[model samples]
Target: MAFEGIWNVVMPMGRSRELVRFSKTDLLSSLQIPSERHLLVAGLETKNDYFEGIPWIVIQHNLDVIRNITISTGPRTESVTKAVDLYLEQIKVRGNKTLSDY
Candidate 1:
């Protein structure tokens, strides 16, 4: 299998959020994953006939409050929380134009 394994997704439901896990087959067959709220895709694990790996952490923010996000990979030097904190600073500097417009 080229892409076979489970995909764990964290999404919002009403007031709080929930983590939902989906099989690769199910996702591919249905071509659907929850998209009603903002998402944070981190730590993807994939397995096939040959090898198993965790290549990247993809972050997808679906709110108009912030428009941009960036991350660095390869050779971890600091704690994950610290890294995220630094990245969040970008949003503070950039300012929330989308919210202000409203």
Candidate 2:
């Protein structure tokens, strides 16, 4: 699979912020795995003139094994958590183990 593509996303989380950066084929071989659906979550620390804080969650998904990714923020609230909740709900309903589970 080719390794290319970038997506920047932002979601609302109370007064805080949820942001994400996605990339492809960056950490596959080291993990030693075949093509499959994958999701990753991480936290980011940042300091700037405007803000000084850490984005404490990130989530990423490999949509068919041909793509890789990185997500800098995931769910962080009760009212809403972006598309991840729907995705996880789908997985749960379908009885499929998520990437984190694997």
TM of each candidate vs. truth: 0.23, 0.18
**Model 2 Cα lDDT, one tens digit per residue, 22-100:** 3344444434323222222111111224332223311222132212232223333321232334444433442343323
The lDDT per prediction is 0.30, 0.29
- For candidate 1, lDDT tens digit of each residue in 1-102? 112132444445555555545444454345332321111212211222332222231223322221232333433323233333444454353233222121
**Residue pairs with backbone atoms closer than 3 Å in model 2 (clashes):** 58-73
Worst 10 residues of 2 by lDDT: 38-47
Against the correct fold, how does model 2 do in TM-score? Answer: 0.18
Q: Candidate 1 — which residues are off by over 4 angstroms?
A: 1-67, 76-79, 93-102
- Candidate 1's error at 101, in angstroms? 31
lDDT at position 19, candidate 2: 52
Predicted structure with the largest TM-score when compared to the true one: 1
What lDDT is obtained when candidate 2 is compared to the true structure? 0.29
Alpha-carbon deviation at 58 in model 2, angstroms: 17
